[model samples]
Target: MAEPREIPEGPAHERVTVVLITWQRREEALVAVRRLLELPERPRVIVLDNASTDGTAQALREAHPRDSAGGRRLDVVVLPENQGAVARNTGVASATTPYVAFCDDDTWWDPGSLERAADLFDADERIAVLTARILVEPGGVEDGIVTELRESPVQGAPGLPGPALGSFLAGASVVRRSAFLQVGGFSRRLWLGGEEELLAADLAAAGWELCYVEDLQIHHQASVLRESTRRRRNGIRNTLWFTWLRRPLPAATRRTRDLLRSLPPDRTSALGVLDAVAGLPWLVRERKVLPPHAEARFAALEESQRTSKSRNYSR
Candidate 1:
């Protein structure tokens, strides 16, 4: 196995901004932002509070302290209600920098991951997102999902940086601000769980590529408080929604069959099916099949998904 790459220290670009989304978990969010602030390059930081009720807003105010007094400039937006993945859309609009890196409250970039991602995007105009290899905290174990990402089946012409990815982990990737906004941010219907797929396909259709760089790394300490069953249901529902939205008829039918065959005969699968059925009207109206080349690229992922242990339909 390749040893982990060290983060580069020099400024890779003029300015890169970090957009972090948080809710309820005030303490974890503070730790992430503090680590980000300690990085040498001094990237700009913004926090989107998704109507956090656990004193998150007050904690941020006390921590920054001088946003109004010539201290570190931290932009904070408090939404009136919880917007889930849509919160990211609101936060990205507030970013003025050339590149934006998305970090969940429980994740933080390695010292120079942001700078290196900026450099990668600068080197290739067609690359929209540079997904970092995520390393789990404390244990230092590689994230289970990284294996599937590293071995992506998406076909790319010769000499690409890494496997051509259909989608990326939103928390572990650095994206071009303009390209991200151009394709439209995460979908509102999908909301939070595994929301990157739809936007990724749209970006690919718009002539953008997503790559995985083994050299880049982000540390993630999975949060303790989570709704696992609900997350699983949402992930399955969103998978179905994205499939119908972009896949050709035969490919979509095959995917549907695979999902049904693999899912356990339990309440979770039933809820997922119900959620997917509830959105059928909108899915039909909004469906725009991918062009031939893109369709082929997506079809390539089916084989990978079949063998991927990381894709288990559970929390």
Candidate 2:
């Protein structure tokens, strides 16, 4: 095997573990596992296969069986059914490391990124998450979300390493284990699409900070095999769910109205709105307004969220 890349600063293995979540996409998961295990930090990995029909879990277990990297530093957890983003909670539970670098099957962190993240976490006990700058594959150009993260208007504590963020991209972020578990890893109701917003809000409410880091990078080669319409539908529903679940009554109502008015006139939008409205009972039961400080942070991001090209709901 080739030499592992240099470990930049912190004790990476002790501080961080990579928790990769995948559903179907067997071949992509295989390649993702290989890249993760090769990281210079030599951090341990837990692959949570979300009950994929594509033989994803079995292929992963076969590829990295016991006695190699599999035994020494890898684990594969095959969920019995698709738990959506909550599937990641299981992986996070099993991680012994204090921090987890969350990965999607199509995304992987840079060699020294985990180490840098650990150093940041060590320096600030209040920091609960650090979302990295993402560069897409092939050409290695910045992802559209990078600009939003880099220019985040949310005010952070004095010692944060970069701009304060109202939300983070889970696949490209490192989160503190304690804070994540404290707020419940991800909402079971929201499932997969746009789930990070809820968790980020809760973490902020609990006095934890989240910020963007430019040097800590993750590379995403978005998978070609995806249901864009389904994802779009789910994302729209989750966005409405989160808004009503936490935002103040006025804010929630306004956001809901704005969202509905802006949605394209199509079956998908109608279906998504229906998805949101159908859960009125449970959503009403679980709704809790955000504390002033946390709500303020989100309020700060309103202008950017409204105008963002990357925040489009239409496919």
Q: Which candidate achieves the best TM-score against the true structure?
A: 2
lDDT per residue for candidate 1 within 194-292, as digits (tens), equals 789899888888777888889889999989977788888988899999999889899999998898888888898889989999999999999999877
- Assess every candidate by TM-score: 0.93, 0.95
Model 1, which residues run further than 4 Å from truth? Answer: 1-14, 67-69
Clashes per prediction?
Answer: 0, 0
Each prediction's RMSD to truth: 5.1, 5.3
Any residue pairs clashing in model 2, and if so which?
none
Deviation (Å) of 182 in candidate 2: 0.8
Q: How do the residues 1-315 of candidate 2 rate in per-residue lDDT, one tens digit apiece?
A: 112223334479988999999998999999998999999899999999888999988888888778845356778888999987898899999998888999999999999999999988877778889999899997899999899889889998887899998999899999988789888899888988999999999999988999999999999999998878988899999999999899999888778877787789999999999999999998899999999999999889877877888986967
How does model 1 score by TM-score?
Answer: 0.93
Model 2 misplaced regions, further than 4 Å: 1-10, 68-70
